[model samples]
Target: MRIALGVEYDGSEYCGWQSQPSGGSVQDALEAALSKIACSDVRVTTAGRTDTGVHASYQVLHFDTQAQRPMNAWVRGVNALLPDSIAALWALQTTDDFHARYCASERCYLYLLLNHPVRPGLYHGKIGWFHQALDVERMRVAAQMLLGEHDFSAFRAAECQAKSPVRNLTRLEITRQGDIIAFELRANGFLHHMVRNIVGCLIYVGKGKYPPEWMRKLLEGRKRSDAAPTFSAAGLYLAGITYDPKWKLPHFVEPPLAALLPRMSRPGQSGCNMKIR
Candidate 1:
């Protein structure tokens, strides 16, 4: 049977989501625990491969297993052997056609920025920090240029293996509450470091280093060098993934950061729980 799981992780201690020969990856830890549970070698696939230090609140993945244990076994059992940084949130038997990556329709991400003179102490490694004051209104205006279908080559990483640079960015919402700023984006797909690169450029605009229209120019330029440097991975989170309605996957719950901030009155400015298109 095919089993799908909702996984969450603090990606600080391990490598990225993908397994490597060096062996400190969320995938390696999960597969090791799962192999013990299934009594056989098991391979799994994920909806997205996050970079090192990138967190995920609701990462989705699937594996083919013949072991007929109860669903709780997959959840609690696998989690038991996994490290404290990784967890299996839910498990469900899925159709053979349901793939974790190929079947995904949309992906959502959140980037948190702690905009204060003092560096973050309590939330270190969990948020990006900027000492300069940022204008949220300018950042929001700059971010609007990224919405809809476009060639995002300017924001893609050099090592990106995706066949195409064109992606449909359905949403890009920016909001701020006191010293905390949040950026939420939903897209049909993302290039390597795309969100981080966009955030870097937005930060430039927010700090008055560039005009909001500079974002449009950078998008049109289609040159990676024209955009700002890639932002830190510490603040990025794989918020959720959307599959076809037929799959009926559980929705992602809002993380506590949302409740701590006042709600923005903008159209797409809902809390951290992103709306899937």
Candidate 2:
């Protein structure tokens, strides 16, 4: 049978999502617990591969297993065996044609930044920090240029193995509240470090280092060297994935941090917090 699972993880402790020869990967840990439960080797495939120090609120994966255990065994039982930083949130028996990666129609990511003079103490490694003041309106305006289909080679990493640099970015929304800024993006697909690179350029515009129109120029340049440096991975989150209606997957998976922030408020208001959707 084919089993699909919703995973949430703190990528801070692992070497990224994929398994490596050195063995400190989320996949390695999950497969170990799954192998123990199945009493045999079991391989799994994911919707997307995240980089080191990145986090995921909702990650989907599937494995072909003949163990025939209860659904709870794959969820609660596997979570019990996994470390505190990793978990299998839900499990379901899926159709033979369902694939975690190819079946995804779109992927969403959220990047959080603490734009304050003081560095974060309590939320370190959970958010990106910028000491200088930033103009959210400028950043928002700059981000809109990235919408629609484009050759995004300027934002892609050098080591990215994707066959093409073209991608259709559907959304790029920026909002701020009390020194906290959230960048939410949705796309048909993303190249390696694409989001981070875009964020870096946006930061430059936000800080008055560049005009909002520069974003379009960089996109047209199509050279990685023309863009700003990649932003920190700590603030990035694989927010969720959208699949065909036939799969019946949840629309919002709710990152752990989302629960801790306030639901509504204006920027600079006292005790204001925002959730990236």
Using TM-score as the measure, which candidate wins? Answer: 2
Clashing pairs in 2: none
Clashes within 3 Å, all models in order: 0, 0
List residue ranges in candidate 2 displaced over 4 A.
253-256, 260-269, 275-277
Prediction 2 global C-alpha lDDT: 0.88
Candidate 1 wrongly placed segments (more than 4 Å) = 253-277
Q: Which lDDT tens digits does candidate 2 get at residues 83-170?
A: 9989888998999899999999999998888888877776777788888989999999999999999999999999999999999999
User: Can you give the TM-score per candidate against the true fold?
Assistant: 0.92, 0.95
